[model samples]
Target: MADYVKDIRAKVGHMPLVMVGVGGAYIKDGKVLLQERADTGGWGLPGGYMEYGERVEETLKREFKEDAGLEILSYRFLTNFDQEFFTYPNGDQTQVLTPFYLVTAVKNQPAAFDKHETKAIAFFDFDHLPEIHFASHKKILAYLKTLL
Candidate 1:
């Protein structure tokens, strides 16, 4: 409990500073890649917080590799955001993240491995997106409808 509090205190020190991230509709065969959060076991796109000393797009590229085991060809901004809220089953609270990206797969590829961050990674039809952890993801997908 003390550790979590200390971490929250340190994060708060970054004032008005929340996490920025990147994720996308990695579409193939008219379907998109989706992930289930290991912590919550709910569905979401594969992404994580932007790391220090890394370009935002680079973060997306790296996280795609780390979380979904895919290499991105090109990614453009879907939107920049300033909203997200979080809760943990163990009572840990966190600020939700603002994410950006409209990405597509590079080359004809097969699923590799993203061993730690994700347990399941697969493609799903847009109209049939599975029940996901984050409700915001459905909104994100709706936006993708405009793009694709």
Candidate 2:
């Protein structure tokens, strides 16, 4: 979670806060980047909630770097959708409006988990992806297959 989100959660306490977040599908060699989330232990794209005054692309770039230690070389918007209300294990509730991007990674930076939010990072063939952590991500992967 972002520092500002923590502050907001301190005030709201389990209320469904509407948040805008960004995620990227970093593709190389017929594979896409995925992370095993430390909090959930489920595989998902590298991303997080947007910070105040940041553009969506900025959020994508910052989060991919923070979670996976890789910089995006370029990206194209994939989709924006309203996620169903999600209740975290800690009881925080969020309704996220998230944007997904198809991104290419900058060369020379071997992607690795940041060890804070992500437990592991790897590229997976779409047909062999691990169990996806969230329904929104599942939908995104399905959409990606159509593009392939």
Candidate 3:
């Protein structure tokens, strides 16, 4: 997938950029933090693209703090990811190459940001799932089950 993204960058010679994001488990007493993507109005792990000169870990920290409104202690690299393009109702595409990280947060029930891009945010358990924003994301959540 990395190769594919590199190929895209090389082929386009323009910023057909790859986007990465970090989603933490933030498990405390059996809960996980999630955010509803404003794009699809589905519950999803919080993450965004890797910024210029920024590390993957930094991206995770910033994204977690921004979307979940929490201070996180530490995180582990859970997986390297590739998700299919998501098309909006307007027919625009949000194509991305995603990196997922599982982090532990300092707070349990953190208050997330109320913003244009996030419709809702909360914690979800194993038995429950917020309407997932993308099909590939659901696979990521499913992969998480094996880790537990």
Candidate 4:
């Protein structure tokens, strides 16, 4: 969690808060990169919450580096989802609003990833995507496929 979110949670204590977040679809060749999350043990796009005064693109770049060890070279806005309510494993709840992106270029790519929030990273063909962890992410990908 970001320090901003931690500070808010310290005050609110599991109360549902509306938060802004960012994520990206890094499609390479014919596959999209997905992170196997440590928290849910389910595959989803690499992303995280925005910190105070940080731009959405900044958050997306930071999250990709922290979660998957990839350096985002360039990205474009994909779509924004309506607020989606979600509960954390620790009982913290949030109404998350996400801005999704299409990562166009990157570097420092790795074949395997093991991080605090991510268990592993791999690319998957759209038709054979893993069980997605978030409803919003599933919706985003479903919508993205129409453009591919």
Q: Considering lDDT, which of the candidate structures 1 and 2 is the better prediction for this target?
A: 2
The residue-level lDDT of candidate 4 at 133 comes to 90
In candidate 1, where is summed lDDT lowest over 10 consecutive residues? Answer: 1-10
For model 2 the local lDDT of residue 24 reads 85
- By TM-score, the candidates rank as 2, 4, 1, 3
TM-score for candidate 1, residues paired by index: 0.78
Q: For all the candidates, what are their Cα RMSDs to the real structure?
A: 4.6, 1.7, 5.6, 1.8
lDDT of 2 by residue, 1-148 (tens): 4587889988889888899878888878888888899888899988889988788999998999888888878888988878656788899888899888888546476675578889888889999999998888898888887888
User: What are the runs in model 1 whose C-alpha is more than 4 Å off?
Assistant: 1-17
Pairs of colliding residues, candidate 1: 43-133
Q: Counting only residues 3 or more apart in sequence or on different chains, how many pairs clash (N, Cα, C under 3 Å) in candidate 2? A: 0
The 10-residue segment of model 4 with minimum total lDDT is: 107-116
Summarize candidate 4's per-residue lDDT along 30-80 as a digit string, tens digits: 788899999889989899899998988999998888777788899999788
What's the residue-level lDDT of 133 in candidate 3?
72
Per-model TM-score versus the true fold: 0.78, 0.92, 0.74, 0.92
lDDT of 2: 0.85
Instruction: Give the TM-score comparing model 4 with the true structure, all chains together.
Output: 0.92
Judged by lDDT, which candidate is best?
4
lDDT preference between candidates 1 and 4, better one: 4
Ranked by TM-score, the better of candidates 3 and 4 is 4
